[model samples]
Target: MGVCPECRAATYQMRQGKLREEDCLRCGWLAIVGADGTCRCCRAAVRLGEDPAWLRAVLERRLLPAGRPLQLALRMDGLRLKTLPLRQTRPLTTVKLPSWARGRPAELQDDPCVCVTEVPGQLGLFAPCPRSFTREHGTRIRGRTPVEWPIVLAELKAIAAERGVGETWLVHTGDGARLALASRPPTERLVSPEALVDLPQMRPTVQLVLQRAGLLARPRPRLVPGWWSKGRGSCRDCLAWTNGNDQRCRDCQMWGHTHADGPCHRCGRGLPLRDGHCRRCLLLLAETEYDLDHIALEGGDQLWFGGPYAPHLKTTTNRAGEQTGLYGRRRLQTKRRIAVQTSRATAHTVSEHLAIPGQLLLFHALRDWSRLDGRPLPALTPNAEALLADFTSHIRARGWTLPGNQASLSALKFLVAHLGADAPFHETDVRLLAHHPNFAAPRVINYLRAIGLLVPDEKSDALLATARRYADEAPAAFQDGVHRWIDVMCNAGTRPSLPLAPSTVHGYVRRARTCLNIWHTVGIDDLRAITADHITTVLDTLTGETRKTTATAVRSLFRALKREKLIFRDPTRGITLTVAIPLPKALPDERLVGALDLLPFARDKLSLTLAAVHALGVHDQRGLLLDDLDRARGRLTVRRAGRLDRTIYLDELTHQLIKKWLAERHRRWPSSTNPHLLVTARTSADDNHPKVHPRAISKPLSRIGLQPGRLRMDRILDEATHTEDPVHLIRLFGLSPITAMRYVRAAHPDRYRPLPIAP
Candidate 1:
């Protein structure tokens, strides 16, 4: 071995690593290099003082954002690393109709706006946002539809010849069909295309091609009025003036014609006939068959009832639950394919708001609610009575306010109606059944669990939901590890420490997910595959507080895994982190100094006084009782969380504010049973013993662009400026030792303000 070095010295060569020859990435010259194909020629050129313009240009292109996608992407194809040209999707280009085509409907131009699309032998004519455009002059949407240069050039040549606005015009020479867009009405929002129901057309394949060319933006759904129909909310429930002279809806008109000189031929009843049958008969016919618009008689086809422009009946629901439609119609709709279907738009799409059924019955077997089926709610069962009694007791025991207590009961009733008589209840089903005005899912679940009607199967909160969502993206083993970690955080007695709050667990999961995502990008998914080096690499990418948060979350995950013996070793065992808390600054004098004068209520004024002057947190102020305030001693005692109560001598301003509030509180609730020093009508009106929520003390201040915590910090900081003692702050504000120390350090002149940590 020693003699080999002497022989190798005579060869005079450098052996860097096991290598393969590859073409230089930048230049055509062959180079002895690694798999990346990085060569010395480019480096040598730069070292020899060649212009770096090419390098600078490449860097900008790589680092800077190009609004459109890049042409080439570095990807691995099979075993080979290759830069492939990306497939760029073409977007739609919108153009107006030809001059020959008419724009809007004839009646008032009846809500005018002619929008149309066409394919070979088929044309789609639409009148969108007719209500808006009927009288107003045309307004243009700001975004421009991007067109291919070659196509645009040809289109412009024809437009230029005709001296037209090329962007808004499209003319088909072979078919002599042209669509000319007019400036009829200006719309602030995106418009949905409403089909010209009378003007029939269908060519789905060709439609797709044309749509791909003309669409600039696919707008999120907005309220666009239905054409030639009653579209307002009032109209859906027969609240608007009747269309078809006397008919409740288009469905009713189609059901039977009114007094067509005899009784209905089908039902043989002497009533106003629609399509030669009674309204009920026609509705019955619709359920069993299609083509109800044109009824067939023995002699000839029945006349079309009502005109095409009648309003459809509004969908509705009651105690039977909000139904989209019957299962028979739902299954049929799913199997449906594109045909010459009319483009219809209507509000009340959800139909949950229609608490009462409409007069007209909608056909087609979709939706359960019909005017005939609308029935009164059923009586509560013995079980339901017992459940409500127990739930009410539970609510009172927990000290729920009047509104909160009522909402839980209402939510239960809704679920009962939704499930009908026999369907079992689940936490998710309860959540989904809750409608607008009162989303009473969480409270309802608490009631159900307390009564033992439902088991706890779902994630208790949003944090677990969020963690589970991200965990699903990982490998099965890694996902199991994540969920296991969550179980530890959520379940009691899983750790020596008290169980994590939903919010805390949620935050931890979110941070852990961030690390997992970064690791997965580098081909690592399993927790066992991850090393301390991998964690270090992820930490380096995040800075300051983010880095610390990510580190803590990662360490927690690894620690949990190691504790359960799920992993061989904890990668985070040797890692130690020191994350600084950001300094708090005083609020501007102009903002807080005159806030008291601006405040309208005595309660609000006192709330501000406690926060800004006495350094009392919103929680502390909300928890204060009349007994806690000693007017003779001029002292105020603040109690928050489970900490020791802190008593302080009141300032003259605080005392004056308290005096004003005491007088007001006495006037407002003369017979109130609430023992709290500050009580609102909500807590005072009822003897339910419900305490004031933190929002009561904070909302008024929040509305005026002030925060209680921020004001408390400013007050504490002002005191800390006088003396740098943490113990003094703790005794004065009843802050925990840690928080008090943080306040002192933040206010120190030697300390510089850093970015605020997220939590």
Candidate 2:
């Protein structure tokens, strides 16, 4: 009890609505009451019927910031409103179920009725209700009939929704008529209740509850077009004219045929698809995968269908402006066509020796054949054809061997394959060639350009900029000094001058570039700044012949600089040559013979011949003609470099092997017009001779661990150790006296057993 301001005592009873006064029980003093239900003594009003916004505002103002929940609960008279702070009230969960519940079932006489609190409805808001009726306070409620479960559930749901509570579960208690109303939804529901009940119409309600419990899956709707059952007419939603009364546009329904992940790649049926293929297209996709697998397996061996060699077609025209085909261009094309056809036929043959992996690469190449035509090539000018003709004439005039002719033609073929026939050459083609793995070597590029096939592109950074860097970075005085030395060495007239070969000159230039780099590194780019110390650093860093070459190049550079008065002393003055006699590196006799015996005809014919000739003490092998071989005398007249020729007597083994090779060669190339003893497998020019490529001959020897130079040395050593007479050495192996002395000096002193004097 509290006291009012005027009265000393106050009543605790509250009254509202029309009643304005309350008498104090103790003193009988009347207290004034406001319509808002505020106590006159305490000046406090009941929280009932307060505006939701005002309540929220007051809560936000009074409550500490950390204590505020995302949703604030305002307990009004008839409604517990969940609201945002300082905002209006709105329900969070809106679960709207159809009103399909029927009347409640009657209680059974056989089963005892379970007493339960009556579930309240709309009146429960303002008035007190049974504990069972309030889902928030009670745990269980009982009903007599299971058939009435749907109706009871409907009522419970409505009550829960009105009170702003979450889900409630209806669990069977197994008692006569008792059911449990859980505060939260059950994870698993009991289906035995439905099994015992015989209510056909209420089965759906049971299903609904089971669905909420997640014990049963929701029903799937039938996938049918809405317009199928309706008559054909224009759609109201979209203004497009329709074949049927379809409301959706055709594009919308195109992929909506099924409820699966996506449309089937083949039949437009919605699906879970793979490789963009449906069941209908699966076979095609599988076949493609099989082919690719086989192709990849074959490609792993580094062989492809259009490989071994990429094909090219060449055509020749006569003076009458018509293709005369006299140059055998047509014949060559026919041969290539036959070869391709034969390869494809073999691929399809499916022989036991030729597996699927071997042929599948060819099949892949066939697939890509059509696209290869459009591949970009190096561009050339109209004068390129004339230049090529003139170049070929020049090569012939120089008396290059048949192999040299073939090599030049092969390089030209590579050029024509990328740049189409009639395409003019450009400097860009040189840069492009630099990127090629096989032809990109600096030396190779120099050869191609020297032969007039490639021209330098001044604008390109690759070759031109590199050339410029070498030129512009070197001081004019230094480059002039280097070039003057180069010219003196290249000149044949000067006394004490060793005329440099073209390759030697190139090597000197390359070496000078290295010395320039070292000079630049030491911050001395000028010729006058060059010291013996810088030259020594550059030479010391190099080893073997490279060091010797660099030292020589620098020595020449310093000598020229000194003569021009650019330096007071020679930078190369301290450099000295330490010449060491090279010991003969001859292969062991047994290993050499064993390697020769191991050589099979199918492996290589050129290597067999090369090894045999080496064993016969024939060092020179250039331009050896069929006439040069005297098979009757077991002898071969070999042409050495610089027109030095000699006839060497071949042993029985070498002679018989040479005869066998000649027979094999005839059998293999019956139509060959070449007169050279060893000729190229294919021809490029109209010349009658096409010698075997040096690379072709060298490949087998390299594989068999036999070096020609070493084999030649072994033959010379065998002869040198046999006799001390220089005449016998020179006559047997065709060596000069000075050359014989080197072999004699290398031989053991005991091996030089002189013949008994006049015995």
Candidate 3:
């Protein structure tokens, strides 16, 4: 039996785990069982040799109520406890003492030579010292003094418990030591601070003071390397004995060991090789390397290196391993794996053989498959049946604007459906399937051959080559002639005069393509053989802007061909089309007023004014900069398309709108260095200064049911109808003479009276 750590009884066994203490002998209390199978009657604080019990017992006898009052005593260097003569205040009709210090008013007695001070604002003796209690000469003395509040309270508690008193009082000694003594037992008692301190010294009458004054933190056990372990093992690299192997003991392992092999191929570590590399690199090498037979959908798949594919591997290990199956084989859909493999192989083959633009388009189609019809993409397998079905479904899912795009995709899908799953291209005669209108003619056959689908045959290859050129040369019979015609015009020095600007040539070619789509010409030779009657017949089908633009382009193409002597006769010789420009739609007074009223913010008002009153287009408005505004002159300089610059006078409302918006713009982007008047906040902090999206202006106007294009036209018509002068019309609306003439007819149809033709 031994002294219990709790209950102050000798009941616990010396080897408690070997012989459990069920109960304490004197108290008859059951011992509390611990996790380590030891039994304790009370906590360590109440034990015989602990600081708390020893300290409490020492203070109880000397300074507590032997019914004799205690005193505040001090030594020159510090403080000590001694007895004081009791003083009683004169009894009065009513109690003379203040309620707060009713029972303990005697402790407030002064000793001027001693310079006593109380820890104010605290009711209990052992309360924590606040900043107000730690001041000396109206300034904080926390780090300066040795005797702080915690130490003082701890001393007071020791004195109180030893004196058999429930309360203690403290005072600051003139020498800066705070002395405490038993005053009298009060109703409230402070918790003792002895339990909080964890230190080595524990004995009777021991004062558990902080190591540094005012520093209440318990000292933490210092940690040295291998403090808890037995002797550190020998170094792995040099096999030398060491206290701790962590730093390789510096001398034995660090400078002594060098790599037996060069650097590791995977991790680049210069260490002796386990299997031609470090153990870590070997493990990593196994995880990343792939096995086609047992491709894993999850991690930790073992990979085998060596044989045919070993040269492709960055590193290898001595432990040869092979993959048998996937981690989550049951959960992985078979079709998903096939689809992924097919798409990857197809993209790789297309990129290797096709032109850059075609490769990009095909890859985009693959990526945007799910978004094409706003539905989930169907699962596709690598087999021909599944591929063909998925390809058919994809075409029907969304409609494309260009026929050429649809045709190209159809051809690509056909090749992928057959050849993507490693089907032999030699056995699959793609040309034979061309007779079936469901698939496009063998355009994708060359792509399949390039990706190792075909078995080479010189005779068949030569025939396929001729067939491919014929297919490429003829797209649509009508389009074939237009392409040929454009090719002749594009070839430089073949023309009699210097070639027109590329943009002008592009416009002509565009119109020619449109014409071919409208008519039926088998080839370039067929178009060359067209009579004047045929040109007129085609032009008759078109009217207004289409007729004018198309007629001009066709006439230009034929004229160029005639000059080059490519055609014997010019079919467009007598074919002519009149340019007809219609009058712009005028906005109703109420509609205009309603749109202006609906302008929600300053920017909207500014954007609308540029579009409506100033007759600026959306493109021109977006290009407007701070420099374009001439505030002093009250005019704005605008750059229009076709390299045209126009200066327009700003009205008072327009000027104010611009000014207000500019002020708002400056406030939002105070540090912006972009030259454009409009800007947007960058989505990322690292992005460059942003130009406002075109939709920013359009979306606001659209909300108000005002179209920017229609507003510009309304402004043009307003000027045209009101002024009636062609010159004014040209200057204000930026119209050509021909366009102004059309406006003149609309404004004053009866201005030109025709004299009757007499017989």
For all the candidates, what are their Cα RMSDs to the real structure? 29.6, 31.6, 25.1
Off by over 4 Å in 1: 1-376, 379-433, 436-475, 490-498, 573-581, 625-635, 640-642, 659-699, 702-705, 724-726, 736-759
Better of 1 and 3 by TM-score: 1
- Writing each residue's lDDT as its tens digit, candidate 3 over 450-535 gives 45555443454343344234324443543444444455555643543554555665667666665554444534335566677766
Better of 2 and 3 by lDDT: 3
Give per-residue CA lDDT, model 1, range 1-759, as digits (tens).
111111132222212123323333344334443233333434344334353653453434321111211122223347432221111211122323233232223232212233322233432356533222210121221111222323433544554467654333332220111111222123322111332111112223213322433522253475544554553222221223433434355554443342353576765656655446654444444433443243444554233233353323222345777523321344233322111132112111222322232234353222222331333334454555566566677666645555755666776764454343233355655665454345466667655655555535545566667777877866555788888887777763245655777778878888888787778778885788889899898898889888988888889899888877788999999877666656789889888767888899999999999888888787677778888889999997776555676887998998999999999987766666678887887787544446788899899999889999999889998998888888988887777897887777777858645439633
Q: RMSD of candidate 3 to the true fold? A: 25.1
Q: Model 1 misses residue 396 by how many Å?
A: 18
Candidate 3 residue runs with Cα over 4 Å from true position: 1-190, 194-504, 514-526, 536-548, 576-580, 597-603, 639-645, 664-674, 678-700, 731-734, 750-759
Local distance difference test values of all predictions, in order: 0.55, 0.48, 0.49
Residue 726 in candidate 1 has what lDDT? Answer: 87
- Which pairs of residues collide in candidate 2? 305-362, 380-423, 380-424, 380-425, 381-424, 381-425
Give the winner by TM-score. 1
Cα lDDT of model 2 by residue, 168-238, tens digit: 33232122112332211223233333332332122454444444543344343654454354566543322
Model 3 TM: 0.38
Residue 602 Cα positional deviation in candidate 1, in Å, after optimal superposition:
2.8
